[model samples]
Target: MIALIDYGMGNLRSVAKALEAAGAQEVKVTAHAKVIAKAQKLVLPGVGAMNEAIAELKKLKLAEVIKEHIFKKPFLGICLGLQLLFTESEEGGRTLGLGVFEGRVKRFSNKLKVPHMGWNNIRTQNSELRTQKCFALNNIPANAHFYFCHSYYVVPEDKSLIATTTEYGGEFVSSISKDNLFACQFHPEKSQSVGLRLLENFVRL
Candidate 1:
């Protein structure tokens, strides 16, 4: 079973449907720790404020559960889900995060638009290695377009973790892949065919 974590945020049903379309036989949207623990894979998809999301996760005691199982399974994070893995976020005046990755979430510069919405193409960082080893990006063509909607973005301390980069105002980290984990700032559920292909790759992983 693939656990689609629900903390009262995100397009849960849409993501769940998309995962099923990608061939996920069993996808459970749950906040219960036991359900998550038994899941074969975990997907964290969310939107809205980071502080509120973290507060909800902690209130439901799902945060620790996620941390414990994150490295043990094929974990995927989307949008706010991706942002929460970092050490802290500037979203609400230095709100702390899961600390899974050594990084900080930053807001886009004032020169450009606040929410970097709509379609954008992601370029694979290291085509040779990523194409061969990154299962989440498997069969996904480089420079393929994906849907994005967010004002904040992650900046990891370790550049090696960066899987893909996209340009809005300038180049920004679009996705990151390391071991059993893969995350992106874009929403695969809304990206159409290429997005479905990406999810299909993740389901196969």
Candidate 2:
């Protein structure tokens, strides 16, 4: 079973449907810790404020469970879910995050549009993906365009964790991976064929 975490706000149904379409036999959207912990895979997808998401996770006691099982299973984070893995974010203020990775999230410079809402091409960092064997990008075309909609982006302390990058106002961390944890700032559910291939790759992993 694949657990699609529901933290009160997100494109939950879309993600669930996408996962099913990608050939996942079972996909459960839940906040219960036991159900989440026992799932074969975990996917955290969100589209809202970081602080509120964190608060909801804590209220349901799912934060600790996530931190515990994240590295033990195939885990994927999407959008705000990706941002929450960082140490902190500058969304509303200094909102603390899961701290799974040593990094901070910052808003794009005003030079470009604030919320980068559209399709953008993600250029894979060759050496890192080859060395790490990033399964998510496996069988997916190079320079594929994925759907993105966010103002802030992650800045990991280790550049090697960046699996892919996209340029909005200069290049930003579009996707990251470390061990069993894989995350993307873009929304695969809205990305069409290329996105489905990526999700299928993850499911096969």
Candidate 3:
């Protein structure tokens, strides 16, 4: 079963629907740690303030459960979900993340626009190298457009973790992959066909 984590901040219904459409036979949207712990895969999808989201995860003690699952199973994070895996976020004054990756979530520069919304194309890293292909991006074409709505983006200390980069005013890390984990700053659920393909790849993985 796939656990679509519900910590009161994610777009759960839409994400769940997308997963089903992507061929996930079982997708459970639950806040219960027991349910999450038993899931074969975990999908963390979120929006809104990082501080509040992290607080809710801690309050429910899902944070540690999520950490344990990440190391042993397939984990996918969307938008703020991706941000939460970092060491910390500048959003709302240095909110701490799960620290799965060494990075900081930073707001877009004032010169550019806040909340970089709408469709943006992403260039996958090492798309030419078969060995370096990201499983989440399987069958997804290069420069595929994905939906995005966020003020902040992640900057991982380990550049090798970056899977894709998108340009909005300037280039920013759009996705990252390491071991069994794949996370993206964009909303694959809202990205239409290409997005569905990405989710399907995750489901199959």
Candidate 4:
């Protein structure tokens, strides 16, 4: 079963419906930490400010549960879910993040358009994915377009964790992976065929 964590700040229904369409037999969107702990796989999808997201997680006490098991299971984070894994964010005056990875999320420069919306293709960074064999990106064509909607992006201190990158103002971390944890700044759920393929790959994993 996959637990789609609902911290009162995510697009829970769309994520759940996407998982179902991707062949996930069971998916539970819940705020209860116990439900999250017992699930075999976990999906953290979020939208909105990092500060509010963190506050909800803390209020529900799911933050600790997530910090404890994020690396143990097949954990996937989407959009804000990806940003929350970092140490801090500049979205709302340098708000702190979950600190699972050494990085900071920064807003796009005013020189470029704020909130980079619409479709963009990502360049795979992981060596295993170089041959186009990474499980999450399996069968998906190279430089495939994925839907995106965000104003800020993560910058991991350890470049090795970067799975894919996309260029907006410049190149930014588009996706990240380390062991059981995988996350992406793009909305795979909304990326059409390639998007569904990514979700299918995650469910299969």
Q: How many residue pairs clash in each candidate?
A: 0, 0, 0, 0
Worst 10 residues of 4 by lDDT: 125-134
- 143-199 in candidate 3: lDDT tens per residue? 899999999999999888888988888788999998778999999999999999999
State the lDDT of candidate 2 residue by residue for 6-25, as single tens digits: 98976699999998899999
**Which lDDT tens digits does candidate 4 get at residues 93-200?**
989999999999999999988789999998875443321235687787778999999999999998878888888988888888887678999999999889999999
lDDT of 2 at 78: 94
| Candidate 4 ranges with C-alpha deviation above 4 Å | 125-133
Provide the lDDT at 44 for model 1.
97
Better of 3 and 4 by lDDT: 3
Residue pairs whose backbone atoms clash in candidate 1: none
* Candidate 1 C-alpha lDDT tens digits along 128-195: 32322367888787879999999999999888888898888878889998987999999999999899
- The TM-scores of all predictions, comma-separated, are 0.95, 0.95, 0.95, 0.95
Worst 10 residues of 2 by lDDT: 124-133
Overall lDDT per candidate, in order of appearance: 0.91, 0.88, 0.91, 0.89
lDDT of 3: 0.91
Model 4: per-residue Cα lDDT at residue 38: 95
lDDT for 110 (candidate 2):
86
Candidate that beats the other on TM-score, 1 or 4, i.e. the better one: 1
